[model samples]
Target: MSRNRTRFLKEFPKAISDENAAVFIGAGVSVGAGYPSWKELLREIGDELGVKSDDVYDLAALAQWSVSDTGGATRIRQVIRDQIAVDHDIPAPLNILARMPIRHLWTTNYDRLIERALLAIRRPCSVISAQGDLALKVTAGAARVYKMHGTVDQLDEIVISTDDYELFRSRRGAFLPLLQAHLSSFSMLFLGLSFTDPNLRHVLSLIRESFTDAPPAHFAIVRPPQKGDFRSAEEFEARLAQHNLWAKDLQRYGLFAIEIEDYDEVPGLLAEVERRVARNRVWISGSWPLDEATTPEVSFVHDVAERVGGVVGSSGLTLVSGSGLLVGSGSMSGFLSSLQKTGAWDLERRLIVRPFPQPIEGGEPDRAQWDLLRAELARLAGHVVFIGGLKAEAGALVDSSGVHAERAIAQAKGAYLLPIGATGGAAATIAAELIGSDLRFDGPDALRPSDEQLASLGDASVGAAELANRVLKILKSRML
Candidate 1:
């Protein structure tokens, strides 16, 4: 492999490995997608208002004029939306985006390039703009795009004016939470951003204020400081470091910062990233079986549900197996202890547990064992769950019962299948690949916890409550 390709591949795994990896896009990315540059956009706005581009460069100054003008940001947004909605060619940046295993994208640009890119790929994604009636929380679980700045169509929502910027600074409480949440948990990768944008700077500042306890983790692409025009890389890094934003040396990390002389190169770069992610199988996890691995393994349970939500007959299968038993408990405890829980526990219906280990050595497999095991699965209306991993050890039992255990519950007929592993995390991404859709959740709120612990499941990382929530979501999705 070439040096650039090799470096890209190395970083590729790191990006995929993160469950909360986010792509923070900026105006630069949109430029590749045929969107206007900030200067160009200002020029157009100036023409419409009988002013010069230089006059409108400052969003606050432009907004100040808006009080006297017919419209402010709204008109600008219309022009943007119209241009993007009609454009047919795939923008270069989006093409580059096609390859990466990015679950969420945070963009400050108002254009719909990200959405358009996703649409071109035929992936379903949510567009969150400040102007829209929709709130960010509703899109919590959605996996595709999160537009932090107001979209072009909703110019009123864009924070451009000095007053508007001040308002945003004061009301940072409203939107900063989502920003902090993403930064705290996910590894953020920024693209096409400039430090000069007030909104971006403000966000960086707000994150610093709220995250005083400890510096949060995030990554961004920046120009390597040259000696003459811009400040030294050291100075730039210092400024970012002060705010806890770690500036990456793109070249050092194997990321080539080339001037896009011909916007065409953008698509190829994006395509390469997409190709890498597609070739690599990304594992998603949250269910108990994933934890069963003594070492790390790529499992796809957390994001699968939304990925395959549209597929036929995927719904309503009460999947019983070691996974289900393990998931509902947040750990192996319930299934392990229940295996020897004695007399009769109410599994209700659609449950499965591990087989009892033989007490004596060299004991022959007998009928009493069959009857005892069959009775347990029968408690859940004869819907017995089995672990996909049991093939090597439980082959004889599976053969005797005549159950095709390897097949996914979705593939099984007429059964309400609830996959007990990975919480459909990586599976959802795979399902998207198979079904050719990108419908996935972006936030933890979409991860519905069961009634047993929903109240306590607030946002704690891992505990019995969190585990219970993960299990119930897997279970109820079966009913839906």
Candidate 2:
């Protein structure tokens, strides 16, 4: 990777983690999901007017011309409705983005694909499509999507004509100031977004005049002009030179432009960002059987889980786990205790505690549904820690299938494994694999568990707190 790309991969995730990052989307993003591009939307009007798309450089002017030619805005609006009504399956790039913990999403497109993608990932979003909607914030648990140009649901208020661009300030009035504030406050990632739009160009000028110093760093993912993009060789050469100049100009506003070969590579780049952001997120997967009396092994496992949870919470790592039988509460209590001792109040943001769905109708639980849930939760972590993996079945203790399934899912997703062998049950076999059979841990050499740490984990003499400290050392080494 280039230095710029590596730097962005490492730093952008941290920006998102610190709540200092935002995403600015464009029509190109939705185009991948079968939405009409500006050219495609205007092509219908162009056909009626006997004009060609190749000849037109400004699409907003084409829209205005169509409005003038028809002597009304009815046909234009209907065409827009028809163009936007076409929907397809969500693209991979959007899905990857939805999985991240982004707070602010800005878009110039009229489609609801952004919010729809977020909702599909189980994240509800408050959309600011108009100035009045800006005050309606979802304070409880939702991200905000700013549809600056307007949305398809409200056809009359959409911004598409040349007049709308020229008079955006007086009409919308509130968006520019808010946008300026956001640009000054957060690092914005421009995905499939360009600076050529009249509204954005106007805001850029406003921001330039508003700030005496350079604005905060921003970025754009752009497709550079290629040789075959145009039929004429001279045209391609000219546009390529223009793109080079455009890249340099972007630095004036502290916007770094990253060029890629194709749009398909976008999902991979986003997955890298997702991986970097989730390194500090730890997922606990285990259960304790409640059949008969709690054995000495069960007690040891429960103690270890609690101490592990306390280490996770106190050290600023986000905890994700399902409410397994007896072990889940121990971890939850330890995490809550740590938060209470530190006087931190952001429990909702710091933890994701999902209760496993109870079995219905059948005596046995649905393996498929549980599999789906475990996969979703494990995707949010860079490390998986297993302990006390036991369940009650036929009134007897047995190794937990959930723990083994979680281990498979986590391993496939390339997470670092930390299983306590001293707790025995399902975790013992897995830990034995680490000691002699296989090296399942996926992390840097500096963060790798030493033989001493692994042996101490399985040793009968090692106490609960000491084992938890060893695990914390590996997790915190990533930060170092």
Candidate 3:
């Protein structure tokens, strides 16, 4: 990955965690979902006026001309509704954005793509198209979608013509104030935008003029101009220069541009952001001897759970665990109690349990059912940690859970896995397998394990704090 991408991956998570992240969607995003751009909509309007759309680059001006020629905005409204409005399935990028924990979304689009995408993901969103909608309180944790230009569903309120642009300051009422507040407060990520709309540019300029100090940093994902779209290499280079210049000028409004090689990269970048934002959720699976509480094996489980609890609780990460007696009951239960003592444990908010709806009733769930539940938990977690177990039923459960976690992590495409061999049981077996497969090893030592260390692991003599620290280290490394 490029340096800009790395920086974005690092900073975006922090922004989401702090509830200070917002998104700005542009016409290009809608276009990807088979909708027309402003120019395309204007082109159709130009055709009605006996003017070639390609000849008119100023879409707002073209819209004004159409409204004046027809003596009203009736034709303009019809054109937008006819050309831009649709009920197509939401695009992948929009779907990812909808599922993210972002609190606010600003869009200059007239279509309902953003709202549709959010609805598809079952994410509650309060749509703001007019000033009256601003007074309504949004549900807690629901995203607020600010349709700055107006939605196609309400043609009369849509901002398209140059006259609308000129009067936008006065007509928008509380919209501009709310937008300005978000700009000053949140870290905004602008997607699929060309930064060419005059009305939006003007509003941005006004915001910049009002700020004496540096404003909060914002970002835009821009594609470098393609050579295939130009007549010659020289023409392409000139276009690239102009694009670069426009991107640099946007810095005046505190919007830094992260240039991608092409539009195809956008979805991948957005998906990565979603993954990182979800990284706060972690899952743990393992088992130890439940019969003897004073045994080193059982003691290891309690000690490690306590230390891991502190890390998860303090870091504000959610913990997901199964309901198994030794693995889930011993580890997660202890962790929850520790967090409760610190006043950081909220069962509804900070914890998630798998196997709640028992796959089988009247008896112990079958092995396949347990595996399925563990897989589901692993799929939801950004990291999975395994601790201890022997060849008995408890150890068998631990081994199966570890295998399920590994498969789920693979299916997820990316997730951190920590198997502490020092804690013994299923964890030791998994660690040995990883070493043998050359998937992971202890530093530069390769598969060479000291006999004494291996013996200590089997004997469960490793300190719980040491095992917990190692797990935390692996989890942190994956985040970076």
- All candidates' lDDT scores? 0.43, 0.77, 0.70
Per-residue C-alpha lDDT of model 2 across residues 1-480, encoded as one tens digit per residue? 155576677678887877788998876788778887677777888999899855687877888888789887788889888878556688888788788888888888888788889888778888888878877756566888888888888887788888778777787878878877888888788888654443456545755654537566777777777776688999989888877897778778777777787888888888878877778788877887666335777677778889998998899888888877666778887888899889985686678887888876558777788888888887888778888687778877777877988888887886777787777767776776666545634445222255566677776467898888888887888742
On TM-score, the candidate that comes out on top is 2
lDDT of 1 by residue, 1-480 (tens): 244345544464345433446777877666655666665655666776677765444655664565447544566555555664456465566655643446677777776667777767556677766533335354433446666656666555665556666666454335567766766666566666655554565656655554534433444544433335335877656655532333333323222333333335545555544433322221111232333434232122222222222111122222233222222222233323333344333232112344433446577656576445433333222111221222123333111121232223222221222222223233222222323222222222121223223222222235323444453454344321
Cα distance off (Å), candidate 3, residue 114: 1.9
Best-to-worst ranking by lDDT: 2, 3, 1
Model 3 CA deviation exceeding 4 Å by range = 1-3, 198-200, 206-212, 231-238, 278-280, 287-299, 315-318, 322-326, 329-355, 359-380, 388-398, 401-412, 422-425, 440-459, 478-480
Task: Please give the RMSD to the true structure for each candidate, in Å.
Answer: 17.4, 3.1, 4.4
> TM-score-based ranking, best first?
2, 3, 1
Give one clash count per candidate, in the order shown: 46, 0, 1
**Per-residue alpha-carbon lDDT of candidate 3 for residues 345-415, written as tens digits (9 for 90 to 100):** 46665677884444554576476766566665765666666666543463343454444454455335455
Query: TM-score per candidate, in order?
Result: 0.46, 0.89, 0.83
